[model samples]
Target: MTEFLPPWPLLTAFVLASLALAITPGPAVVYIVTRTLAQGRQAGLASIGAVALGNLGNAIGASLGLAVLFSVSALAFSVVKYAGAAYLIWLGIRALRGGAAAADGGTVEAAPRSLRQVVRDGFVVALLNPKTAIFFAAFLPQFMNPAGSALTQSLALGVAFVLIAATTDACYVMAAAAVMPALRRAGRARALGRYLTGAAFIGLGVFTAASGSRAAK
Candidate 1:
C-alpha cells in the first residue's frame, strides 16, 4: 500500500486540512477553557494534557483498524453518537444548576472534579468521537504510499496529526487563560464555562447525529 501516500499535491492538502481542523473550536477546546477558568490554571492544564493523550489513543485506534470497524457499523456508530450527545446534555444541565461563585468574584467553581475524573472525561469525550476515526481513516490515506507499508504510513500520518492538534489546542488554552482576570471580574465566569462546556457536548451530539447525512454528501 505504499501507493497509499499521496505525492506533493496530497501532502500539501494534508497540511492545510490539518491546520484548519486544529484551529476549529470543538469539545476538547471548550472543556480546557472551562476547566482553566473554573478550577484554576492547574486544573485546566491537566485537562489539556489528558485530552492530548487521548488524541494519541484515537490516532492509534484509527491506524490499528478501529476506523474500519466503526465506520461500517451503523449500530455501533449510533451507540457512540447518542452516548456522546447525552453526556453533553448532562454536562450542560449540571452547569446551569450550579449557583456558586468563585472567591475572585469573577468566576465560580461549581464542583471541583478530580484530575483523574477530568482526564477520564476527556479520554471518553475524544475516544468516542467518530469524527476522529473517520478523519484519520480518510485523511491519512490521502497522504499514504501504496507501494509502502499502509499501516506504517497511516500510523506516521496519524501521529503527526495528533501532534499538530495538541499544539494548537494548547495555544487555545493559553489564550483563554490570558483572559481569566477580566472574565473573573464578571462573577459568572464559572457559570459561563459550565454552560459552554455543556454547549460543546450538545453541539458535538448534533454533529454526530448528522454524520450519516454528511457521509452521503
Candidate 2:
C-alpha cells in the first residue's frame, strides 16, 4: 500500500497556500463583516466560531475521503451545492425584506445575537458551502505524499486552513468594530448597508447555482 503522508516541503507549501486563500476576501469574509457591522464584534466572533466548527466538519469529511466522494458523485455535489445556493438566496431575501421594514420606521436593535445562535448559524453556513468542500477535495491532493497517511495529511492541511481563516475573520471583526458606531448612528445608512449585503448574498447564490458541474476526482 502506498503511503499518503505529505512531505515537509509539501506541508510547508500547503500551509502557505491555505493561509493565503483564507485571507483572500470571500463570501465568509462578507458574512462576517456584515454580521459584525450589523450586530457588533461579538456577533462577528460568534459567526467565526460557527464557521470554524463547520470547517472542522469539512476537514473531517475530507480526511474520511467524503470530499473525494463529492468530487466523484455528481448527484451528491449537486444536492449540496443547490442546497447551499438556495440557503444563500433565502438569506438574501430575508435581509432585503428586513431592510425594507427598517426603512419604514421599524426599530433596529444594536444588541448582538447570542453566541450559541451565531456559532450554529456560522457552522451551517460554512459547512454547507460546496465551494469549501470542493476546495479541500482538490487543493489537498496536490501536496499529498504517496508514502504518508492520507488522513493525517488531510487533517493537517485542514487545521492550517481553519487557523488562517480564524485569524483573518478576527481582523474582519475589528474592521467592523471601527464602523459600528457609524452604522448605529445612521438608520438609513444601516438599512442601505443591509440591502447591499443582501444583494451580495443573492449574487453569490446565483453564482453558486451557475457554477459548472465537476467530475469527482
Candidate 3:
C-alpha cells in the first residue's frame, strides 16, 4: 500500500491543491449551504455526507474510465449536465411554490424536508454533475507515480480529495447555520429567506448549464 503512494513533494502539492479546490465555492458548496440555511445543521451535515458519497462515486467512475467517455462524447456530457440542471431548477421552483403557499396560509416557515429526502437530493445533485468525474480524472493523475499501481494511487488520491472537500463543506454549513437564526428572526424575513434560497438555486442551475468544462479546472 505504501509503495503505491507518491513522493513527499508530489503528495504535498496534491494536498495543497485539493485544499484550494475544496475551499473554492462551487455547486456542491452552494447546495449544502442552501440546505443548511433552509433546514438546519442536521440537514447540512446530512447533505455533506451524501455529497461526499456521490463525489466518491464520481472518483471511482473516473478510475473506471467514465471520464474518457464524457471527453469523447458530447451527448453523454450534455445528458448528465442537463439532468442535473433540471433537477436544481425543479428544486428551486418547488421551494418558491412552498414559500408562496406558506405566505398564503399565514405560516412563517415552509415544511421541513425529511433527512432521507435531503440525502437523496444531495446525492443526486453531486452525482449528476459530470464535471466532478471529469475533474477527478483530470486532476488525480498529476501526482501519481507512474511506476505505482495506477488503480490504487487513483483511489487513494480520490479519497483524500473527497475527505478534504467534506471538511470544507462542513465549515460552510456551520457558518451558514450560525447566521440562520438572524435570518429567520421575523416571519417576513423567514419568507424572504425562502425566496432567496429559491433564487439562489435557480441561479446555480443556470450557471451550471452555461458553464464550460473549464470551470471545473
Candidate 4:
C-alpha cells in the first residue's frame, strides 16, 4: 500500500479539478441530463448511479495500464473512440424509432422504460465512452507519486473522482426535476424533450468521431 495519502494541497487541487470537470457538461453529463428530461427524477438518479460504477471501472482500467496502451498506440485509441461513437449514434437511432405517449395524456413525455433498462443502458453508455476512458488515462497520472505505489494512488484518486461525479450528477437531476413539471405542461416540450435527447446522443457521436487520430501522450 502507498502508506502516504496525497498531501492536503494536492488533495485540494484534485477536488477542485474534479468539481470543475463534473460541472462541465460533457458527453456523460449530456447523457445524464437528457435522461432526466426524458424520464423522471428516479430514472435520472438511477442512471447517475449506474454511470458512476461504469466510470469506476474505467478508472481501474486506467490504473491497470490501459492508459499506457492508449498512449503508445494511436490505432488503439482510434479504434476505441470510433467504436464508441458508433454506439452512441446507434442509440440515437433507437431513440428516434421509439415513442411513448404520456401515461396521463398530458404534455409531459417519458420514455417507456423499466428501471432495469435505465440502469443497464446507462451503464453501457458510460462504459463504452472512449473519451471518458482516455480522460481517466490522462488525468489520474498527474496526481500519482512516482516513488509510491501506483496502484494505491490510482485507486484513491479514482474513488474520489467517482464520488464527486455522482454527487454533481445528483445535483443536476434534482435541478432538472424541479422544472420538469412546468415543462411537462407544454406539449411542445414533450416532443422537444425526445428530439433534444436524441439529438444530444447524435451530437456526442459526431463529436467523438471528430476527435483526431493522435492519442495524447
Q: Give the per-residue lDDT of model 3 (tens digit) for 40-93.
A: 999999999999998999999999899889888999999998898898888888
**Candidate 4 — what's its lDDT?**
0.76
**TM-scores for all predictions:** 0.79, 0.84, 0.94, 0.86
lDDT of each: 0.68, 0.75, 0.87, 0.76
lDDT of 4 by residue, 1-217 (tens): 4444566667788889989888876667778878888888998999898899888877888878876787778888778778778877877766655534343355432354788988887887677655566777778778766777778787789889999999988898999889999999987876777777778888878887897633221
Range of the 10 consecutive residues with the lowest summed lDDT in candidate 4? 101-110
Evaluation by lDDT, superior candidate among 3 and 4: 3
Model 3 vs truth, CA RMSD: 1.9
**Residue 114 local lDDT, model 3:** 93
The reply for model 3, stretches above 4 Å from the true place, is 106-112
* Whole-structure CA lDDT of model 1: 0.68
lDDT by residue (tens digit), candidate 2, 132-156? 7667777887988866777777777
Ranking by TM-score: 3, 4, 2, 1
Give lDDT tens digits, candidate 1, residues 122-154: 676666676567667877777776777787778
